[model samples]
Target: MSKDRLISLDVFRGLTILFMTIVNNPGSWSTVYPPLLHSEWHGCTPTDLVFPFFIFIMGVAISFAMPTKSYDNTTFNKIVTRSLRMICLGIFFNFFGKIQLFGLEGIPLVIGRLLITAIVGYALMGNFNAKLKTYLAVSIFIIYLILAYSGIKSYEIVRLPGVLQRIGIVYFIASLLYLKTNQRTQLLVAVGILFGYWALLTLVPAPGFEITNLEKGTNLAAWVDSVLLKGHMWEVTKTWDPEGILSTIPAIAEGIIGVLIGQLLNNAKLIRSQKATQMLIAGIILIVLGQIWNIIFPINKALWTSSYVLYTTGLATLTLSVLYYCIDIADYKKGTKLFLIWGVNPMIVFFLSEIIPQAMVMISFPNPKIATGQINLLDYLYVAGVQPFFSNPMNASLVFALLYVSIWSVMLAYFYKKKMYFKV
Candidate 1:
């Protein structure tokens, strides 16, 4: 396979992150479009597709990075270090939004810390002068230590298993499997994982429950999460985490499926058109099989059900195939730059996206128009700037999300122009 970067893959990744930013950062959760909202329990929404699509893309990336090769310490260390970094960053995300520093508390503290974090992160992660980067990183670290030690308390229970944490874990396992096993073995392992996870959830009952089931907060996955994670579970449903331990088994399968597809795309013998057609056919088959399995398993994103893995991966494959045909095969590259920017620097952008909103919500001011008499920065923007012009609240909310996305797009476009892609 050629070492040149895949424009189609980059565009696909960018599109996923772009939509993710929009759906995740809606101006008002109450006013979000139904399609943007996650299903309350068992089903898929456009929003639900975002996380799986990312994981699948990560798998494809792994295929590109880890060629069929012999084992070596450097390769092993690279995989371990990268996985650890992502996992640590995920945990840091949980802590950063909550940790109060130097009595500042709330929005100001979060925003300030994040700004420092960005500077230090850029210095360390970006291509910069080694000495200067080291000095800047150390100085920032010492300053953060002083502030953190002073008055950083009220650190609430943080959800341990999150989107990035799961991504990290899945990447580590999938990368290893890719390195050690052949393509057929990888495919078998992927299929086996889905079947095994299905059997584990359906046939085995939790300690307290009388029978195996897939009910919310009471299923085997939830029970395992409660047993292991305990207090460190999702705040929305303290009983379980969507990215829980048991559920990650199927998530790994999702990554492996991506790896397989990546291998197909990377096959030099097959022309681009043939690769696209094959992926399209494979996507359709998986979608059909997923629907058939949905009768029993029921495609559930929170549970990361086997059917959900199949369905979402199928959709992701189909999406990537179309992009491959249009961008790589046909060389039709109009409007691809927009997503390419966000795609190249997805991690940093996603991290900022999460924290910015947290800080905005924390920083509130008096608003007499609302019954609460107080409104956060984000709500204030929507209420005063975006809401007045529209009759439908949902439309206003969507516009705010779009504006947020556009701002980030502009910022990322500059970074892309400067060739400053942050890798984590």
Candidate 2:
């Protein structure tokens, strides 16, 4: 095995994933301030940036990590095995990662705070047949629309193709597309998907979709999802799903953007200064283009709008460029020990946050009322320790999450010292 070192790349990935944990597994979601909340319908927020940025970073990582030459059987086998593992893990999270397997006897906890789980399944799974995936995806929605129009059932804890599932489907094709086609074709395909999605949203009126306006309840995407997965829609958005069919068009761009970054990173001959400068310029260009696109597309995380992809991708790339210059070129390895830890095993911490919220939240001291029947360990600490003195729930929650990050950082540092990296 070739053990190549890319300090900046690992650090960038690590820092992004580490912040992902903090924003994802806070002490209390409701208690979080404005920056954490995803924009209600349109616009951006710190929370909104997390997922797309993660995806964008994945694109950057994929570009840097893909082999430069022809694949050998040994390398091919490893890639296949790892890809299969990622796909299965994504499925596990989808079906059972939500339910705390053991209610009381075992270490019971919320398996996942968020419903989106398609990140890995798509990225790794190869789309053997582009036609089949598109057919299946379309078929599922058509069947769902028929059922939904029939008013067969009310929405509840029903599951269907979602963000992760979409990723699996689109990613398979996108990966194949990346390998099978050239760069210009890839860019064209990306643009086509984006515009195609927009046109569909505007032209085809969903059931209950009016000629005047398609509100959240009546939006084409939500209507299609509800119709298809009648009994399987999420409890929260009975009328709409964030990871709906039409919405995924823009989502594919997220993965495609990754492929683009991967391509950029593939040029090994480019000097560090050249790479950094290119990224910074690209970031500036994207931010401006995103703003222009926002006039029509509306940069939305829920929809994963095209503008949103450009805006977030640009930021992610620029950030990576700066970090590369600082960490890899300038050689600042002091406090980076923390980020390097997360860079080692990000998914582990992500899973842990879901597996054990109490630990992530670091619930201590006296517990307080959080949700309907839940009182977090962290809440107790906040009320009994900080709330008595401070009044900001948001600040307290941020502090709590940061503290959790720090504790985990210590563990990560230990593993880093031992030179261990647990990958998916």
User: For each candidate, what is the lDDT?
Assistant: 0.84, 0.63
User: All candidates' TM-scores?
Assistant: 0.91, 0.76
Model 2 lDDT, full chain set: 0.63
Candidate 1 clashing pairs, residues 3+ apart or interchain = none
Model 2 lDDT per residue over 1-424, tens place: 1256567767777877787778865656778877867788889987787777666665556545654634456544444444334444433443443333234222233323222233332332334354443443444345434543444333124355453455454555556566556778888887887777767766777765456233566767777777766655555776767766667677777767667766766667987778778878888888888889888778877666778878887787788778877877787787786776787676666555543553434223333353435444556655566555546778777887787788888888777778665554
Q: Report the alpha-carbon TM-score of model 2 versus the true structure.
A: 0.76
The best candidate in terms of lDDT? 1
Tens digits of per-residue lDDT, candidate 1, 218-336, equal 89999999998776788899999999999999999999999899989889899989999999999999999999999999999999999999999999999999999999989999999
lDDT of 1 at 297: 96
Error of model 1, residue 26, in angstroms? 1.0
